[model samples]
Target: MFTGIIEEKGEVVAIERTGGGALLSVRGPLVTSDARHGDSIAVNGVCLTVVTAERDVFTVDVIRESLDRSSLGTLTEGSAVNLERSVRADQRLGGHIVQGHVDGTATLLSREPGESWDDVRFSLPRPLARYVAEKGSIAIDGISLTVTTVDDESFGVSLIPTTLKLTTLGDRQVGDVVNIEVDVIAKYVERLVARQ
Candidate 1:
């Protein structure tokens, strides 16, 4: 599990494509400092296990399913990605509970810049629409953010200066794809309600 709190911004150093999946190498000095084989790390909202950790880089295997479901396939060698290690039992949950299990991918639709922040809108997948609510929480590319607005077709979030300065969202443009994880609690509530 993770808190969706980004520890650092890392760069995709290599992606070696294979028949069934791909081997991805990332340079994340902070996250890799104490990482080890089998440790879970959230990379762009996807919880991937470290196959090897050394120096300032770590490698993880991305199965075909993950590539097809998330924006990870869109990454290039130099693409910047949000990185966070799994939450510890003793630390505060700075963000919402995030499994790093990306539900789907969303396209960035627009961005309205504020004096000190940015209000960004992204296209919402229809099937997941019911799970999103205004003022609710959602994880975009692993960075937990509050939903400021929502409709059947899209949703919006306000990004503060710190977010824009520290994460990949700052470089996102209209048409860019990002991973989305709706509030897990909402999904559970819907499931229980349906059985009534």
Candidate 2:
């Protein structure tokens, strides 16, 4: 599990494409500092297991399912990504609970930059739209954000100066694709209500 708080921004240094999968090597000193083989790390909101950890760079095998589901397939060498270690039980939940399981991809529609923050809009996937609500927690590229506005087609979030400076969202451009993970609680509530 993760708290949607980004620990650092990492860069993809290498991508070796296997037959059907790919091995991704990311340079993140902080995240890879104590990372071990089999440890889970959130890379751009997708949870991937550590296959190799040597020095500040680690490798993770990207399966076809994960590649197709999220924006991982679009990643290439030199891509910047949000990185976070799994939340420790003893640590505070600074952000909302994030599973690192991306539901779908969203397109950056537009952004209205404020004096100190940016009001960014993103196209919401049709199936995932129902799970998003105004003021609810959402993870965009692994960074937790509250939905400031929501509609059937798109949603918006206010990115403060800190968010703009810390995570990859700060450098996002219009028309760029990002991984989206709606609140897990909403999905569970919907499932339980459906069974009733």
Candidate 3:
């Protein structure tokens, strides 16, 4: 599990294609400092296991299923990614509960810049629209943010200067794809109520 709080911004070093999947190598010194072969790292909101860990870089295999579900397939060498290691029991939940399971991808629709912040909007998938709400928490590319507004087809989030400077969202432009993970608790609640 992760808290959606980005530890650092990493760069994609290389991507090697295999028969049915691809091996992803990322340069994230902070996240790989104590990483091991089996440790989990959240890359752009997807929970991927470390296949190999070196000094400042680690590699993970991205299966075809994962490729179809999220934006990982669109990535290339030199792509900026949000990186966060799995949370420890002693660490505080700075953001929110994030399973690193991306529900789907959203396209950047527009961006409204403010004096000190920016309100960015993204096209929300129809199937996942009901799961999002105004003021609710949503993880965009592994960075936890509050939904500033929500409509039938889109949602917006306000980004502070810190977020604008630290995460990939800062450089995201209209039409760029981003991974989206809605609040997990909401899905659980929906499942329970459906059984009643």
Candidate 4:
């Protein structure tokens, strides 16, 4: 599990294609400092296991299913990604409970700049729309953000300067894809309510 708090902005170093998957190599000095072969790392909201860990870089295999579900498939060698290691048992939950399981991908619709912040709107997938609510939490590319507004087809989030400077959302442009993970608790509640 993760808290959706980005630890560092890592660059994609390499991607080697295999028969049914690709081996992803990312340069994340902070996240790889203590990483091991089996440690879990949240890469752009997807939980991937480390296949190999070196000094400042680690490699993980991205199966076809994961590539189809998230935006990681569009990544290239120099693509920048949000990186966060799995939360330790003793660490505080700075963001929220994030399973690193992306529900789907959302497209950037617009970005309205403010004096000190920016309100960005994204096209929410229809299937995931009901899971999102105004003022609710959502993980976008592994960074936890609050939904400022939501309509039937889209949602918006306000990004502070710190977020713009530290995460990939700062550089995202209209039409670009981002991995979206709705609040896990919301899904659980829906499931329980359905059973009643």
Per-residue CA lDDT of candidate 3, range 106-182, in tens?
A: 99999989999999999999999999999999999999999999999999999999999999989999999999999
Report how far residue 133 has shifted in candidate 1, in Å. Answer: 0.5
TM-score of 3: 0.99
Residue 43 shift from truth in candidate 2, angstroms: 0.4
Give candidate 3 regions above 4 Å deviation.
none
Q: Give the worst 10-residue stretch by lDDT in candidate 4.
A: 15-24
lDDT of each: 0.96, 0.96, 0.96, 0.95
Deviating ranges (above 4 Å) for candidate 4:
none
> Against the hidden reference, what TM-scores do the models get?
0.99, 0.99, 0.99, 0.98
Candidate 1 minimal-lDDT segment of 10 residues: 67-76
Go through the candidates in order and give the C-alpha RMSD of each one to the true structure: 0.6, 0.6, 0.6, 0.7
Candidate 1, overall lDDT?
A: 0.96
Error of 4 at 42 (Å): 0.5
The TM-score that candidate 4 achieves is: 0.98
Candidate 2: 10-residue stretch with minimal lDDT: 15-24
Compose the digit string of candidate 2's lDDT tens values, residues 1-196: 9999999999999999998889999999999999999999999999999999999999999999999999999998999999999998999999999999999999999999999999999999899999999999999999999999999999999999999999999999999999999999999999999999
What are the clash counts of all predictions, listed in order? 0, 0, 0, 0
The digit string of per-residue lDDT tens for model 1 on 1-196 reads 9998899999999999988789999999999999999999999999999999999999999999999999998899999999999999999999999999999999999999999999999999999999999999999999999999999999999999999999999999999999999999999999999999
